[model samples]
Target: MTSTAGYDVERIRSQFPILQRELKGKPLVYFDNAATSQKPQVVIDALVEYYSMYNANIHRGIHTLAEEATAAYEATREAVRAFIGAPSTEEIIFTRGTTEGINLVAYSWGRANILEGDEIIISSLEHHSNIVPWQMLAAEKGAVLKVIPINAHGEILLEEYYKLLNPRTKLVSVVHASNSLGVINPVKVIIDAAHAVGAVVMIDGAQSTVHLDINVQELDCDFFAFSGHKLYAPTGVGALYGKRELLEAMPPFHGGGEMIKEVRFDGTTYNDLPYKFEAGTPNIADTVAMKAALEFINGIGKENIRRHENDLLQYGTEQLRQIPGIQIKGDVAEKVSVISFVAEGIHPQDLGVLLDQQGIAVRTGSHCTMPLMQCLNITGTTRASFAAYNTKEEIDRLVAGLHKAIKILR
Candidate 1:
């Protein structure tokens, strides 16, 4: 509710109830934060409060419950608008998650604007969600899909990206950070380069929103999408931030109750910016609960969280580098709190199973970026992603688990 001037880590950790839970007689070491963060009691409580006290459909109802529910729902929008530093609340559109958000952009903007012989640009580090929707759109629109290749360290080649951008480029959809490699792209630079050639840019902020400071106005990105679940909120709720002019220009993604101004047998008129994108009933409780999650992060300070998690990344990277046969994936210096690695003679699945037996939860697989793995010449990597709640002690446990697993596997 206020500026995150003085962050308190311990106080913040105390708010998350799952952090206090034990798994198989040991405290849960939740290093799989990149997948979905554990929700705080405050966010959980918000869900309870909404369902228990004010349960009603919002916007159109006039009953007392509807009024209260509407206020709570609208508050979450304001919270999201403030969280991303959006120009206006109208610019923030609710979606299921990043996947749905990207799809919305593709269907609405890409389908409408993209033409034959036009090009759509994305990087090699994109999640399948980012890649598939654009490819589908490009195919449907008869537009060409151009990929900005990543170097050995998994960082996008800026020169290659710039060279790919020209008058033919209609849209540039890039991830703000890689979910698998943990590489944070120079999105502002990318956006500027795309704009120089008159292409609209959409940034998939699913990974970046949690750790980095975001000022959408400052970045001047045309569209920004992120999932609430990745940012310590409930799943099934996320937001899409678009510049007002662009959102106003684009057609509605879906046709339904809340998104319409009027419905006639022959034709229908759409509502304003955000409501036009959010069709039908939304994830009401989870959407309302997201404000509490954003408040929790705001209380802790995103910059402070970034500092702590970056420290964890550095510590985990160095410790894993010392292990025999262990190789870190994507040695990009600019990264978030995610560390993905592989061990010689050990499958990532086996490593994950062994780590879980020791109460160290980690993710191992393609991690929703199968193409990225193919590019890296690997099937998958065992990924341990950190949050503000994670600590050096947890990193030590991870390292210990890896050492024991390595000895047995070898």
Candidate 2:
């Protein structure tokens, strides 16, 4: 396993209370980080503090609790803005998760801009969240959906992607990284090419935001969406980063109490910038706690986290490759800490079950990217995703468990 000097992994692991638990007479080895990361005690304590101290609705109340709640909630918006290097807090609109963020854009921006003959482009590596919303938008608007092809290595075919761009290309929405394959795409190039065709680009940052350093301005993407849970934050909370001009131009995604300026029986005017997209009362407690998650990452440093995860990816890849019947998918040069594989004559679901019996948590399915599975000519894969707290010792346990699984099943 790779090592970075001065990185204390054990110290980091201690922060997560759930990691101390055991299952089925074995220590829990969590490898399902891609599904959802384990929350640290600090994040949990933040949630508790919010509920116990100042539990109130935000933006509408004038009391002390309301002011505190609103401040904490809005503070997260600024944190997210800095996290992704967005220009302003006004550009950050909070949503349920990555799925809702994409849907908001499709419903609001897609409906307002896309014409009958326009073409919307996406890659074969997108999650269903990124793909389905655009598909609905395209069908509703009579716009054509174009897909960029991928190589056998699971990297996007950049040459083929350029050929799909033309004047009729209205939008290009692609994932910054593949959730199933862990392949990091060249989004800046994709964005630049789409801009050349006068098309707006939206990046599904559900996978990338936690791993990579993202700057929306540098990437020049029109929209960027990511889930908070992927970055060690609470579920049901995410943020969408849209260009100021684009967010201002797009209509409100939902109509409700807070997203209003002057509501009359004749007509109602919408609120400015981010508030226009965030309708009604939001998940205030979770939103406030999300700031603590970001702080947790910042305290550890993203570089150190990346180094540790990459070490796990490398060590796991080597160990898994030694198994005779195992076939690893998506062997790309650049990837996150995810490994998807399948064994000969064994079903992934069955393997997942056996692994769980050994207290090894993994995900086994199409991973919400059925098209990618179909493209790769597989049913599904057993995925082991790593996080910062994961260690080489855990990978050793996983390898041993896989050997046991092979011996029993094969």
Worst lDDT 10-window in candidate 1: 1-10
Model 2, range 65-101, lDDT digits (tens) per residue?
Answer: 9999999999999999999999999999999889999
Steric collisions counted per model? 0, 0
Which prediction has the highest TM-score against the true structure?
A: 2
Clash count for candidate 1 is 0
Identify the runs in model 1 with alpha carbons over 4 angstroms from their true place.
Answer: 1-9
**Candidate 2 clash pair list:** none
What clash pairs does model 1 have? none
lDDT of 1 by residue, 69-166 (tens): 98999999999999999989999998999999999999998888999999999999999999999999888888999999988779899999988989
lDDT of candidate model 2 versus the reference = 0.93
- C-alpha lDDT (0 to 100) for residue 400 of candidate 2: 93
